[model samples]
Target: MGDRATLFPVKHVIALDVGGTGMKAALVRADGTLLHEDRRATGRERGPEAVVAGILDFADELRVLGERRFGEPALAAGVGVPGVIDEARGVAVFAANLGWRDVPLRALLSARLAGVPVALGHDVRTGGLAEGRIGAGQGTDRFLYLALGTGIAGAIGVGGRIDPGAHGSAGEIGHVVVRPGGPPCGCGQSGCLERLASASAVGQSWATACGDPSADAAACARAVEAGDPRARAVWAEAVAALADGLVTGITLLDPRMLIIGGGLAEAGDTLFTPLRAAVSERITFQHLPDIVPAALGDTAGCLGAGLLAWDLLSTEVSA
Candidate 1:
C-alpha cells in the first residue's frame, strides 16, 4: 500500500478588483503576501450579466490556481467593484460604466465559490483602505485618496476605516463644482471638478491648446518639461482646479494627508510641485494636509480586496 499522505493546510484568500474595462485578481496569503496574480478583460461591452460571468470565472480560475500551487483552496473571497455599492447587502447598486444595477454580487460569488465567505466593496474606497492601512497613509489617522484617471473620485479614510456615508456615496468629490460655467460633465453638471482636473480633462485641454487632438496627459506633461508654454498653461490650469477641489475636501474632512493616484499622478513632481503651491496659496485657517502620491499604484485595490477577505474571515471566526 502507498504511504499515508500528510495533510498540510495552506491558508489563502482570493481577491479581485473589477473595473469597467478589466479585472485584477490575486491569491493572497494570510500575512498579506500574494501567492499569484492575474488580469482579465471585464468584457463589459457584452453587458452586465456577461461581465458578472467574467468576474466569477476569473475568480474560480484564481481559486483553482491557488489550490494547485498551495495544496488547498482559498478560505474566502473579496471583490472590489466600481460605482455605488451596497456593502451591507453585498450588492453592486449602480455602475454606469459597467451597466450594473442592484446585482447581488456577493451572494452569487459565494454560491459560485461553494459557500466561501465573500465581501464586496466600492473600488475607490477599497483602494483607499489599502492606502491607509499599508501604503502611503500608513500611520496617518485620517487621509483622503483621490483617483484622477479617466475621471476623478475620492475615498475618505478615518481611523483605519473608509467612511462610505449613509448613501454609500460619501466621496464623490469629482462632482464638486470648481468652475461654475465651464465644460460639461457626464454627470450632467457643468464645471465639475472632474471636468477641470481629471487626467482626461487635462489631456483634452492640452490637445485643444496645442491643436493636436490626440495629445494625452502624459504627452502634455512631457511638453511642459520641454518648456512648451501651451502645455505649461494647461498643466497649471489643471493644478489650480485640483487644488481648489482638494482645499474644499480639507476644509470639510480635515484629513492628515491627501494621497493622489491614477493616471494624472504619473506626472510626478510636475503635478505635485505646482499642486502644493496652489493649495498652500488657497488655505487660510485649515491645517494643510500633506499631499502625497499613492505608494501602491495599481495594486492598492487588489490589496484592499485581500484585506476585506481577511476581515470577513476574522468576522466569521469571531461570530
Candidate 2:
C-alpha cells in the first residue's frame, strides 16, 4: 500500500447499481448530478469472479470518463447490490438472486479499483433512501418504498434514512406469505407476496385467468380497460394481496407514506387506483398514509448509490 493517503484526497466517487440483469455506474458531482454513466450486463451465473470483474471494468471506464470530464477520477466508490448485505463491514452477506454468500465485497472492490475506499449497501435500501430524501418520499419522516418488478422488494425509511434492520432484511415486504401454500416462490416458500403481486405475478395471474399463459401484463391492462372479466380478476387479486401485506406494514410501522416504485408502478392509475382502493378498504383505525408513485423511476438505485459515494467523497475532499 502506498503511504500517500493524505495527499490524494478523492474529490468524487463512482457509484454502481448491481442488478441480476445489469449493472449501472456513474460519476456524480456533489450536487447529485451525474457527470458520466455506463452500464454492463451482469452474467451472474457465470460465477462471482466474472461478475466482480465486470464491475471493476465498469469502474475503470468511469475513472477514465471522470478524469476526462470532471478533472479527476472519483476518489472512492459506492456499490448497491440487491440482496442481504452487511454495509457496516462492506460484505455481501447474501444475494439470493446471484447465489453469493459471505462475499467480502468491499475488500474485493477496493483491491480491484486500486485502494479507493468503497462503500457497499443494499440496493433497495439505497433506492429507498433516494426516494425518501429526494423523490416521492421526500419531506416525509417514515415511509415504505416498494419495488414491484421481476421480483418484489422494498426499502424501509424513517426520518429520511433507510433502516436495513439488524439483519439487513428489514423491508422485504414481498416475502411476507400472503397465499399460504398457494404458488411456489423462488425462495422455496409457498405463496409469498412476490409470487402474488409482482409484475411477473400479475402477468401470470392474468394469463391463467384467461387460460392463456402468454398474456402480457400491459395487454391485460388494456383488456381490463375494455371490461375483460379475466383481466379484472387477475388485477384484483394482485391488488388484494398487495393490500394484505401493506396493511400489515402500516399497522406495524405506521409509516407516514408509501412510495411504490418499479415496473408495475409505471402502470400509473391502472395499478394505483385499485391498490389505493384495496388498502383503504382494509384500513380501520389509523390515519392512512398517502400512497404515491416513485418520482425517480428506474434511476433511483443508481442515483442513491451516487448519493452514497458523494457523501463519502465530500468527507474526503474536506479532510
Candidate 3:
C-alpha cells in the first residue's frame, strides 16, 4: 500500500463550482490545465441534505479517480458556492438557492479528502478572480466584472486580486438603486439595478410587451434583430437602466476595464452596441473604461475554483 501510494500521481487539484441547479467540477494541473471535467445535477429538488451529500460523493469520486489515474490523490480542493459566505471562516453562511445555512463547507471538504487543504469562496467573486487573473481582465491591473443573469451581481478586481470587501460583500452592484421609487426589490430597495436591467427583468418586460408570458431576453434580442418596435422598446429600457447602474459603478470603482458576462451578454453586439453608447453618453467626470464581453463564458467559475485550490497550495508552500 505504501509503495502504491508513492506511485500515485500527485500533480492535480480538484475544483468544484456548485450552482443552484447543477455543479461543474474539474481535476486541474498546476499550470492551469484541465485534466478532467464533469458536470452533475445539483438535485436541489431532493432537498439540501441530499445536495450536500451529492457534492461530497462527487468530490470523493474525483479524489479516488486521481489516485487511480495519476497515482496519487489531489493535493487540495477549492469550491465556489453562491450566497453569503464567511470566507475568512470557511463557512457558507447562507445560500437561499441551495437552502444552505451556516454550512462549514471547508471543514467538511477537508475531512472528506483525508485532511487535504480546502478553499471556499463566493461564486461570483470566484468567477471574477478568474476573469481578472486569466480571462477577460488578464493583463489589466484593475477591472469590474458584471454578470447580468437572473439577477445582476458584480466583482471588483484590484491589482490582480479580487476585493471581497470588508464585510465579504463588495461588488453587489445589483442592489444599487438606479430608479428611485420605480420598483420594489427583494432587498427592500426601490428600483434596484437588477430589478431594471437583469436578464430576468428584460424577459419580464418583453413578455409583457409581446403578450407572450414565456418570452425571454433571448426572444427580445431576436425581435430587436428582426426590427420589432415593441421588442426594441423593451430592449432599450433595459439597456438604459443598465447604463445608469454601470455609470454608478464606474464613478466609484474607476476600473480600467468593465468586463460583462452572464445570460444577457449572449445578446452579443445587440446588447453591447446600445449599452456602450448609453454608458458613453452618461459619463461626465469619470474616465470611460473599456467595455468587453467575458471570454470564458460558463467555464469561468470552474476555472476560478481551480485557481483557488492552486492559490491555497501556493500559500502553504510560501509559509
lDDT of each: 0.92, 0.83, 0.91
Ranking by TM-score: 1, 3, 2
Q: What is candidate 3's local distance difference test score?
A: 0.91
**Lowest lDDT block of 10, candidate 1:** 1-10
- Kindly report which residue stretches of model 1 are placed more than 4 angstroms away from their true locations once superposed: 1-8
* TM-score of every candidate: 0.96, 0.91, 0.95
Question: How many steric clashes between backbone atoms does each model show?
Answer: 0, 1, 5
The residue-by-residue lDDT of candidate 2 on 1-319, one tens digit each, is 2222334444567889999889988776666676566777999989977887787788877766666555555778888997789888889988777877888988988887778888899988888888998888879989999998888898888876788898778988899998898898878899999999898888877877787778767777887788888788888888899999999889888999999988877778998999999999999997799999999877788889878776766667799
CA shift at 253, candidate 3, in angstroms? 0.7
Tens-digit per-residue lDDT, 261-295, candidate 3: 99999999999999999999999999999999998
**Pairing residues by index, what is the TM-score of model 3?**
0.95
> Could you say which candidate leads in lDDT?
1
**RMSD, one per candidate, in order:** 3.1, 4.6, 2.9
Order the candidates by lDDT, highest first.
Answer: 1, 3, 2
- Per-residue alpha-carbon lDDT of candidate 1 for residues 67-165, written as tens digits (9 for 90 to 100): 777777889999999998999999999999999899999999999998899999999998999999999999999999999998899999989889999
